[model samples]
Target: MARVSQAHLDARRRQILDGARRCFTRNGFHATSMQDVFKETGLSSGAVYRYFRGKNELIRAVAEEAFDRMRLAFESAGREAPLRPLDEVIDGVLTRALEEQARRAGTDRPGAFAELILQVWSETLRDESLAATLHALYDRMRVMWVVVVRTYQDAGHLRADVPADHVVRVLMALIQGFIVQRAVFKDVGGELSSGLRALLSPEADPHYRG
Candidate 1:
């Protein structure tokens, strides 16, 4: 018997994960089964199970991979020397997310990634471990936002009086709302960057007296 190289093992694991993502995206979490994954990947039950104990573990792994990418996007944006404008940074991150989704789904549909996210969010309600994983990932992303908020405050771009955490919460809410809208409606007309600019800019809204 020949031993498998680490690269071979890694590729096999990725193949299983990619197949699982396709299954989950196509039929959703509850609808997809280990058998579906096996059929999709054309791998034996033993081969798939060797990498993942069960469907729940596979689901968790898939969700973690997606969220970790998001976390890394924010982490990279936060580290820029002269950080890009908030709206541009957000737009870039969203673009990257959609691109990744398109690559995974083998289509350029705008909501493919968003729909997968909705499924994960629904699954979290039933899976405590999944919920914890997502919560931790979100917390790390929120910290990145906090760092952004403080950076802007120090640079006099955002109001110094506003709590950083509060701003971070609103930012997260805006992104979440965008995802939900995109997933459900499939056409979220109007530019998110423009909306962010308007909301963040004191002079962009004339009717306000803040």
Candidate 2:
């Protein structure tokens, strides 16, 4: 019998993760079973178990994948050529995120991405290990956002009156609020995108005299 190649193994893992994502999205983490994941993937029990030992492990992997995607999006916003306007950077990030969500929606996974994130948040409340892991990831993300925000401040786009940490905290709160609202109330994408740009724009603040 031939052994599976590394590429094949990686592909199989992604397949399992995708199925797990859908299952958790449709049914909350506590309600989703390994059988549901197996059914979602259309894979044999043995194949599913080979990738994830149980639902807990599968959910953790799903959470990691979600945050990794978010991290990439945030990093991209900070990396435009010649430094675009702060509002434009924010719009770029929001547009990419919403586009990805729409791509999932096109596949009959409408709102599943955001739903899965809410599922993770609920799971974190009851799972100490998962909570710690996600806390660390959020901390790292906060640090990244600080860098992004400070970069803008240094570029004279954002006000220096607010500390980077404070600014990032408010931004993160707005983002989380938008995600929750978008998940529950469909069609808020346009409003949320516009709000993000407006909130981050320099014009939102009266010119600081200090």
- TM-scores, each model vs. reference: 0.92, 0.87
Question: For model 1, what is the alpha-carbon lDDT of residue 86?
Answer: 73
lDDT of 1 by residue, 1-210 (tens): 999999999999999999998888788888999999999999999999999999999999999998898788777877762367777777678867866865786567758788889889999999999999999999989977798888877776666677999998998899888889888998874578888987877556465344
Which regions of candidate 2 fall more than 4 Å away from where they truly are? 101-110
What's the lDDT for candidate 1?
A: 0.84
Best model per TM-score? 1
RMSD to the hidden true structure, all candidates: 2.2, 2.4
lDDT of 2: 0.76
